[model samples]
Each structure stands twice: as structure tokens, then as C-alpha cells.
Target chain A: MATQTTDVGQAVGGAAKVGMPQLDFSTFSNQIFWLIITLVVIYFILSRIALPRIGGALADRAGTITNDLAEAEDLKSQALAAEEAYEKALADARAEAQNINVLMRAEIQGQLDEELAKADAQISGRTKEAAAELAEIRNAAKANVKVVAKAVAKEIVAALGGKADAKTVTAAVTERMKG
Target chain B: MATETHGEAEAGLVFHPMDQFQVTPLFGAGPVEWFTITNATLWMGLSILVIFVILVLGARGRALVPTRSQSIAELAYGFIYKMVEDVTGKDGVAYFPYIMTLFMFIVVANFLGLLPMAFTTTSHIAVTAVMAMAVFLAVTVLGFVKNGFGFLSVFWISSAPLILRPILALIEVISYFVRPVSHSIRLAGNMMAGHAVIKVFAAFAPLVLISTGIGLVVTPLSILAITAIYALEVLVSFIQAYVFAILTCVYLRDALHPHH
Candidate 1:
């Protein structure tokens, strides 16, 4: 600390003249000197090291964010491609199933049509043979009737008390059969 | 309370509110020679040391996910950088370091003063004027250096009527010269007034005991006023620092684009 006299001397010399010490011009150079010193030091620290570090941190964060977003976008596009491929595979499988069903129906219909055609041919051949047999039986029956008629007429004529000729009886019987 | 008042009585209750601002040589008994270390110098140095510790050492880690101290340092850096960039546009960003230095010094000095028994160097015109004058000189020189004789057009009002152009130019020149005066005074005045008001209220804290009955009511009231004013001064300190820095940016903007 300064001696009382010197302190008083300085105080009276400068501060006392001006009501406020701030208005005291005598101390301006000292304040200015320190101000310059402090400012210069602060400027160097901020410019050289402190500011650059902060700027680096900010730039790093922005780069990381951009990189992450790009990766996420790539992943999203890949997922979309996979989904499209899956859908296409599903549609292809459905078309194959439909094709198989149509082929089986066509094959089964061909087999059923072949069986029906064979059965129809067998029935038509049996009806034709039965009709020929019927016609032959009818002709044989008519010939027998004529022979029996001639015999019966001759016997009747003999039993009656009148003589009967074989030629007359045959002629009458032939006429009647013809009519 | 009685003991406190007793101490005050023994020390003589005369309160020298302005005594806190007095500049004294810190060392030997002598006049404050140009180089003599003084209280003002000590506090100014302390402000610088505090800023260095917070910004340089605190940011040494420089983590992606920053520590608390690192976060503070980064925040201050970004805040001033953005301010300078926005106010003066991209071209003016080159001066960011200087502007940032001014902001840090004033803010630190203002905050340091809030400490008990601390000297507020920023409250004096001596300190603030130097900074303001520096801004003024730097801007003026830049304006001239960049624009040559065309720099005088900043004061000329070409848009005004022909008859009024000369008169407007005169007004502009006067206002331009007043920039440093207003800039320095605005900060120092605000700081000094707030501090002095707080001190005045504090001085009254002990005055109540002189009146026996009134002491009970007045002492608490005085304390309350001190609390209120102290809070206001804290806000004032931050605002004044911000104002000084931003105004510097505005002036820098003019230098870069005088047409505006």
C-alpha cells in the first residue's frame, strides 16, 4: 500500500479534480494499456485455437448427419426392391397353379368322352342282329301253317261221308291262304 | 444487527459510494506512473485470465458430445459467430475474431464486477472509450481503404432533394462522428448508474439505526431494494456488453456496404 501522503497526493491530484474518478483523464492511459493487452490476448485465443475447435465440432456433426441420412435412404430403396421381387414371385406361383388346374380338367374330359363313344357303338351292333333273327322266325312259322291246313282239310272231307280228292283240297286251301 | 452496526460505528458510518471506482497504485508509494500496476489493471488482467480458462482450457477436450465447460465455450463461440455473420452478412465475417474478443472482454469484466468487493473496470469511460474509439477508427479506415474517396458518400444523402442534399449530408456527418461518443457512453453510463444505485441502497442499509423505531421497517426495505437493484444490474451488465458488440457489428456493416 502507498504511504498516506502519496495516496492523498494522487487522490487529490486526479480524482478530487473531477467529481467522478471515471472522468479523471489522468488514469486513461493506464486503463487503455490494460484494455489493449486483454483484448489482444483474447483475440489470439479465440482466433487460433478456441474458435477453430468449435467450428470443427459443428462441421463434424453436419457430416455425420448427412452420411447417416444417405445410408438410411440406401437401405429404404433396397427394402423396396426386395418387396417388389417378393410380389412378383407370389404372382408367378398363382399363375402356375391356375395352369395346372386347367391341364388336369382337359385330360379328365378326354378320358370320359372316349368311354362314352365305345358304349354307344356296342348298343347299336346288338340291335341290328336281333332284327334279322326276328324276320327269319316269322317266315318259318307261315310255311308250317300252310302244310297243317292241307292235312286238316283232307281228314275232315274223309270223315264226312263224301269222297275228298287231294288236288281239290290243295287248290281250296291255296286260294284261302292267298286271300 | 447490533454487532454489525457497532462495527460500522467504530469504522465511521460515512459511506463513500464512489470510492470503489478510485484508481490506486497497487505497489509502492508513488504517483500512478504509466507502468504502475493498479486495481483497474489487476481486474482487467483477471478478466482475461478467466476468459482464457473458460475458452482455451475448457475447449481442449473438444468432444463430439461436449462436456459442460466445453459446451459453454462452444455456445459462446457459435453465438458470436452467428451474430457477426448475420449482422454484417458473409463479407463482414472476416472480422469475427475481433468482435468476439470485444464481446468476451466486456462480458467477463461486467460479470467479474458482480463479485463481492470486485472492481468493475467496464463502468469507467477510460476503458470503454478506448474500445469504442478502436471500433470507430477501424471501421473508418476500412471504409476509406475499401472505397477510397467514395467513402465520403456514406455521409452524402443522394436520395434527398437537390436543395436538401447538402443539409442532410451535414447532419449525417455529425451523426457519424457521434457514433463513438454514444457507443462508449451508453455502455459505461448504464454500468456505472446501476452499480452506483446498488451502492447507494447498500449505504442506506445501516442508516436506519439512527432512528430507533424506523430502523425495523427501513432496514428490511433497504435490503429488499438492494436485492431488486442487484438483479437488475446483473441483467444490465449482460445487455450492455451485447449492445456494444452488436453496435460494433452495425458499424462494420456500414464500412462494408456504405450504400445501406
Candidate 2:
């Protein structure tokens, strides 16, 4: 077995040195050439193929982040506008309420003034009518008293039976009454 | 004698036929021999082709909801992106392609090496050294392009207190030059050591009957170790690639901003 193994080893070693076909370049040169080739090939693959995809992915990520941020900003602005509108509506409602209050107060005051004026005029007319009725009653009372006094006086004179000339008697009574 | 028996004992073990793949010089070649493709190169090429085809096909549809292939592609992309971002910050996105490619290629190569009867291209010092040199050159060029001569300020310890300037500057320059050597050696040594250990451990399985049984037990253990090491290699591959890329970025940064 040992002899067989040695024989196989020797044969293999011999074949490697002489019997095998050779190539153009030295092992070192071949390695260098292959290394260069590998480098160029790799450089080509990377620059042409892989990098562009990675760059695109990175750009897409950046763009997505930027878009999301912009959208958030837009939404914030819209919210602010909506809030402002809500406040304006509230203020308008308040202003409208105040205006309605002022108008209502003015209307109530005007109606009150109108009623007061009407009452004042009625009171003045009633006072004037009461004064005129009192004056008429006083005049009628004076007239009645004067009629009764005159009739009584005439009856007395007839009962006393004193004869006199009409014109002289009338003149003497009027002069006595004047004195 | 005992040595001969020991040698015989050592020789009784078997390995897969393809395990014989090795880097050997051509017969009658001079010190600088003619260049030729080895099994390692073939495997490396196949691995590269496989990775490229898979990625290309996976990315074909490029749908919104990813297909399975697209998902795999996207996952790889995302993983590398996160890695870059973690290492170099968001600005590293500019370098995403280069870093990702480096990571994928290294990972696939390491994974391929884990297969039985497969060649580990990364185990070769020449291969790893060249890769490290390429990184070094690219970074150096980037530095110059970005900052001109001002990039040399990274090695200038005079930027600190004048008393320690010479020593510190020497140390910095030495460390800087050593980067490529260390980077290459770290990867290549790890791969070579691990695979050699596995081969040696496997060779021990046929010595004694009890040892053979022990070998059977330990063989699976060694396989498990190999798998673990392979996984570790995968991690190291990514880490080394990342380190290379990030250091390049750092060097570039220094070039771009000298005071930093």
C-alpha cells in the first residue's frame, strides 16, 4: 500500500511538471491579468447596474419623506384657516346678537315714548273738560237764584198795597237802591 | 532501519487525485521560466466566471419585489453598503461599488478554495502580493490625485514635536511600506498553513490499524477543522478586503485633507 501510494504521488507530480499542457502567461502574470479583468468587470457591473438602483431607492426614500412633510404642512395650514373661520363665525354671531339687542331696545323705547305721549294728551283734554263743566254749573246756579229773588220781591211789594205813579215810583226806587 | 519504516508508514496514506495540484516549474526551465497556467489559475478563473455570471443573472430582472436571485443580489449589496457605512461613514457611499466588488470577489474565491480537490488561488504569495500592491498603488494614486504632494504629510512626523520627528518619521515610512507585505502575507500564510496542515493530518490516517481508526476519527475532525478554517478564511477575506478599502479611504482622506 505504501509503495502504491508513493507511486501514485510520483506519477501525479511528474505529470504536473511535464505532461500537462501549458498556457501563455506565467502564473503570476495570469493572476495579475485575471485580477485586472475581475476589477474591470466588477467596476462595470457596479457603475452600470447596482449603483443606479441603490441611488434610486435612496432618492425615493428622501422624496417620500419630503412629500409627507409638505403634506403635513399643508394640512396644518388648512386647519389654521378652518379655525380662523370658526372664530370669525362666532364673532359674527356675537355681533349679530348685539345688533338685534340694540334694535330691540330702541324699538321698545320708541313704543314706550309713544304710549306716554298718548296718555299725557288724554290727561290734558280731561282736565280742560272738567274746568268748563264747573264754570257752566256756577253760571246756572247764579241765574236761578236771581229769578227767585226777583219774584219774591215782587210779591212783597203787592202785599204791602202801596199806590204810586209808575214812572216816578220806578225812579224813586232805583235812586233809593243806588243810594 | 527505523527511519525507513517511519518513512514507509508516512507514505501509506492516500489523498484525492486532484489534491496533487501544485505550483511547480516546467522541466529544464531556467531561474526565470516561461509563463504557464496552473490548476490554481484555472480554478481562479472558474470561480471568477461563476461569481460574475451569478451576479449578472441575479440582477437581470431588477424587480420591485425581488425574485430569489434578486434577493441574493440585494442582500449582497445591502451587506456591503452597511459594511462601508460602518467602516467609513455615509460618505463611503461614493466608494460603494469598488468596496462591494472587492468583498464579493474575495469571498467567492475563499469559498471556492474550501471545496474538495479545488485550488486555493489566494494561497499563492504572488497572487496575494499583487493584490496588495494593486491596493497600495490605487491608494497612492488616489492620494496624489486628491491632495498632490500634500498627502506625504501622513508620513511626516515633523508635524509633531521636532525632537522625535526623525525617528517617528522613519517608523511611519517603514510601517507604511510594510503594509503591502503584511497584508499579502497575512492572507496567503493563513490559507497555505491551513491547507498544508489538513493534507499532513490526512496523510497520517494509514500508519497503524489503531492509528488508522484514530485517523478516521481525526480525519473527520480535521475536516471539521478545515471547514471551520474555511469559514474563518471567508471572514478574513472580507475583513482584509474591507481593511484594504477603508485604509485606502483613510489615506485618501489624509490626501484630501492634509492637516488631518
Best by TM-score: 1
Off by over 4 Å in 2: A1-30, A116-179, B1-97, B111-124, B141-151, B189-237, B254-260
Against the reference, the lDDT scores of all candidates come to: 0.84, 0.64
Which has the greatest DockQ? Answer: 1
**What tens-digit string does per-residue lDDT give for candidate 1 at B108-137?**
999999887889999999889999999999
DockQ of every predicted complex? 0.38, 0.09
TM-score of each: 0.80, 0.62
Off by over 4 Å in 1: A1-18, A107-179, B1-13, B208-212
lDDT score, residue B112, model 2? 78
Clashing pairs in 2: A26-B35
Question: For the second chain of model 2, what is the TM-score against the true structure's chain B?
Answer: 0.76
| lDDT by residue (tens digit), candidate 2, A37-126 | 666776787678665765455456567789999999999999999999999999999999999999999999999999999999999999
**What would the DockQ be for model 2?**
0.09
